[model samples]
Target: MAKGDILKAALSNPNRGPHQTALIRSAIYKEMEQFTATRRLPPSLDASEICRILAPIDRHLTPDDYDRLHKFSDFLAVIDTSPNAHPGYHLLGEKLSADLGL
Candidate 1:
């Protein structure tokens, strides 16, 4: 699945709010940056490479977690490219998902 697809899934989790999603995404990105810097890896590393690096830090996360993380990363990319990006979109998705018992 694409990255946005995974983010949409993550957003489906009822426990996550807009603020929480934003914080999670920011933390993930920051960690990615630090991982890249420390490993002297290329800035354009692929998703698998990123997953490998993140796995050690988030050992409790299953393979599905990595999949969701990659998706959320993609969603962030789309938001970054948009002119009117807002965290509300993710928040709304989460709220709706919760209401639906998803």
Candidate 2:
């Protein structure tokens, strides 16, 4: 599945509480590491970086997981704030913001 699909699946899973989400994020980081090692790509970027960038926006996330969730939230927020935001993203963001009373 696409990365977006994986993220969505993880987000939508009923069993995915905060702890489970952190675990899933860790797994994704590991996979990214393995993939980078095998592919011998540049040493600059990896999943861990993404995770680090995303953690702050997700209250349930720990410091170690900040980048990942931060990146995810940034993406979501962009989609949420974009003038041409997709209908699905707009709707989802609206619902989420409402639920959080943001």
Best by TM-score: 2
Q: How accurate locally, in lDDT, is each candidate?
A: 0.45, 0.45
Q: Candidate 1: misplaced stretches above 4 Å?
A: 1-59, 82-95
Clashes of each: 1, 13
- Sum up the clashes in candidate 1: 1
Task: Give the alpha carbon lDDT tens digit for every residue of 1-102 in model 1.
Answer: 432544445545555444545444545555444332222233344344443343334335545554656554554445535554432343345445655779
Candidate 2 local lDDT, 1-102, one digit each (tens): 433444544544556356656755664564453341222222443465444433222666544443444344334334424554232333344445655779
Structural similarity to truth (TM-score) of each candidate: 0.29, 0.36
Clashing pairs in 1: 3-71
- Candidate 2, backbone clash total: 13
For candidate 1, give the lDDT: 0.45
